[model samples]
Target: MLDLRDVTLVGESIGGVLALTVASALPDRVKAVVASNPYDYDRRYADGVRRGNVFANIAIGSYAIPIFGAINAALENRLFLGWVLRGGFYDKRNLPRDLLAEFDRVGRRRGFRYVERKTFAGWRSWNKARALYKNVKAPVTFVYGDHDWSKPA
Candidate 1:
């Protein structure tokens, strides 16, 4: 905790939920938290954020980009790792190459099995967090898109 910085825990989408866990874990250290398109996963599952190029990298990209690292944790399988530009972001030539490079980096690591285990592990578990949210004592900021659930807070 010595390295704990008094910075805003800005969690975008599910990251928001994770940030909540961190803040709640170290309530005294966390100054505050910002959640965007975040979900109360302890009570509900928020695995429905499939927009932007992010989803393509996490969901469809695996199987579509077979060689890419896509982990279906539940099934313990990896696929092509296809990427989809969400919410009209799919226009060609405009997609950023840096994003692709990031995916490639993530893909090269797992090769499939590794990704699957980690992905599904998160889905099937993460319960201690449930109790944490119910009793969160820190100040929180929540923001969500009217049409989308993954907006930045």
Candidate 2:
């Protein structure tokens, strides 16, 4: 077990949901939380598909499938990953090429594709994490990017 305490948890996207969940579970250890674009709402994935561009719609929708989804995720290239990442930024320039390249490289690691697919498949369960918010005694702050595609303005 981690002998950590008085932690300030910060996370983005699905990670944001995780931070909130952890804070709720360990209110004593977690002193504060910053959740950005938390994936806690119902139909979060469907809404993203509906609002996303053609490329995003295709890429995200395919992840919902079975065998084909795994194949698609496994075959994801740098360009496709760049497109998805840039879509999250209001100013595309904010995502430097080096960071994008690093993200792509990490994504290509063995087992990463399988985990990505599993995370996408588990969205429904993660959405229920919102219920844990009421239990969080720590101060919580939420951040939303101007171009956060997951949320409607």
Candidate 3:
């Protein structure tokens, strides 16, 4: 087992969920946690955002399958990457082109797509982390962007 005493965890997006999970599980060891845009699926539904559902699960799950995931691999190229990032940010025009190019390059590497799909599957498992997040005794802070796509209505 790894010793995690006095650790401060920092994460953004889905990573925020991971930081919270770690902090919750090792409350005595974790010193603090900082998260930005933590993905909370249940909260999204409760707030009537209406994105995640059984069908969405099935669709996201399909991406983890080799054959089905090929489609995602193709679609994740540069053209769509900018569009996706633009939708995530509050200001689309201000998005950095170099960042998008880097993301496109990293995303094209083999197995990145598969791993991404698996990460999406993990998002569906947020309820498990959420349970831990609720029980966390460690100090934690969460930050949110003004136009986060996951914002509840």
Q: Which stretches of candidate 3 lie over 4 Å from their true place?
A: 42-66
Ranking by TM-score: 2, 3, 1
Candidate 3 weakest ten by summed lDDT: 43-52
- In candidate 1, what are the lDDT values of residues 1-153, reduced to their tens digit? 358767578887457778888887777777888877564442222234333456543553343333443334223212323344333243456546677666556655534455443443464345455567755567888886565533342
Of the candidates shown, which would achieve the greatest TM-score relative to the real structure?
2
List the candidates' TM-scores in order. Answer: 0.55, 0.87, 0.78
lDDT of each: 0.53, 0.80, 0.68
Please write out the lDDT profile of model 2 over residues 1-115, one tens digit for every residue: 7899999999987889999999999999999999988877647544453354667767867877888887888888889887876666668778899998898989988899878
**Alpha carbon lDDT at 10, candidate 3:** 95
Q: Would you list the rank order by lDDT, best first? A: 2, 3, 1
Q: What digit string (tens of lDDT, one per residue) describes model 3 on residues 21-119?
A: 988877888898998877766542222112434434344445656776668556656775565556545666877989889988998888887677556
Better model by TM-score: candidate 2 vs candidate 3: 2
Q: What global local distance difference test value does model 2 have? A: 0.80
Residue pairs with backbone overlap in model 3: none
